[model samples]
Target: MTDLNARHAIVTGGGSGIGLAIARSLAGAGADVTITGRTLSRLEEAAAGDPRLHPLAMDVTDESSVADGIAGAVAARGPMAICVANAGVAEGRNLLKTDLTFWRHIMATNLDGAFLTIRESLRSMAALDYGRVIAVSSIAGVRGLKGAPAYSASKHGVIGLIRALSEDFLGKPVTFNAICPAYVDTDIVTRNVNAIRDRAGVTDEEALQMMVSQNRHKRLIDASEVGAAALWLCDPASGSVNGQTIEIAGGQAA
Candidate 1:
């Protein structure tokens, strides 16, 4: 296990699913992990009395909230050495039915949220000698997913943001990367299964299969699998693995 004692890390949307998995992995490695979400109760429940996992209420779509929330976390736990921008909303809508409100909502929570989280974390990370910025992107980011134009575009934007930041801080100690996973077994999938059932007029099991079939292995990925990948990226030996999109898609993504 990589020792991260005394290090401070922040994970947005850490109340559940992939974010919580990543937070647990970091905390297990001895890092002081702060988990943020819009719901305080959910965050606290997820923390489950773990002293290392601190729960914080933060609305990522709001810039002031993100800035102030991150500033307070830094103030309490020292500089942020690891930042995981994992907060996101996943919904699929046909282009003809997609309203501007829906599109902007996705962009706000996915693209803009990652931008704000990374920007605020960088304020302290840039001053330090070692830092890691990890954004949770999706397989849709690398390829277009039918019926989800807005979501796909927003995730693509996240990859672009991370890649550009990697270039901007080239030769610096801080490294930026995005984790792209395919159909992870999370609450997001369960909700989307219901949505798919309604949208496609299929049984719940059939709708779930629709997603399971998308992965090359024909199975839903475990959240812990993605968590392990993130921990690897934060390892001391991963300093050279910057500006990359790691696809945990069970096999060749293409």
Candidate 2:
């Protein structure tokens, strides 16, 4: 629908969840998409015989892995026109209980991973006349989430990086933006439900309800909803919508 034919895109952490959804959306729009994750089998399975979707094994937390993986994608598909930095880990720990290791791990995956992915994609995108860079942040980035200081800080850093890069590339064809969503119904949410159940000593249903209530709409967001937002940003009409954070928090103002 967006007429992304002849375009090449890359989505990091695309084995499942939000990243996979975005990758599928881009591919459905006719872009040749490379989906990367640490698990080759999972990435391949996610590709699921789709000719438009290519799978690559990559570890975002490792600098060399990101650099090489992106390079490989470029070599295979050509210059990247759309880059989605969506690979992230979500975990909540009380500030007093968070150690340096925990903090660094969150930063490395969520913040550093985004930085490296964007930087690598920009290398080839700069030579092209048109490009779009989208980072998957969280509502927590806009406002600090309770008991997840490190995760919140990392997501906030992602938005900061996107905004700064948008400024740096003003007047250029490349546009940078961030997508912030709240309590999406994904595997992450499922895992978080279990964690909360254990930590809060609540039933799984109640724990899930906690997340659902966090969204302004009082329901879990469908992953496809976020995918649609990403697709809209990549549309030709969205060229002017640069350097903005599009919140999919069910009416929550970001």
Which structure among the candidates has the greatest lDDT?
1
Alpha carbon lDDT of residue 77, candidate 1?
94
lDDT, residue 151, candidate 2? 99
How many residue pairs clash (N, CA or C atoms closer than 3 angstroms) in each of the candidate models, in the order given? 0, 0
TM-score of each model, in listed order: 0.99, 0.99
On residues 22-77, what C-alpha lDDT tens digit does candidate 2 reach at each position? 99999999999999988999998999889999999999999999999999899988
lDDT of 1 by residue, 44-76 (tens): 999997899999999999999999999999999
All predictions: root-mean-square deviation over Cα?
0.7, 0.8
* Total clashes in model 1, counting residue pairs 3 or more apart in sequence or in different chains: 0
Lowest-sum lDDT 10-residue window in model 2: 245-254
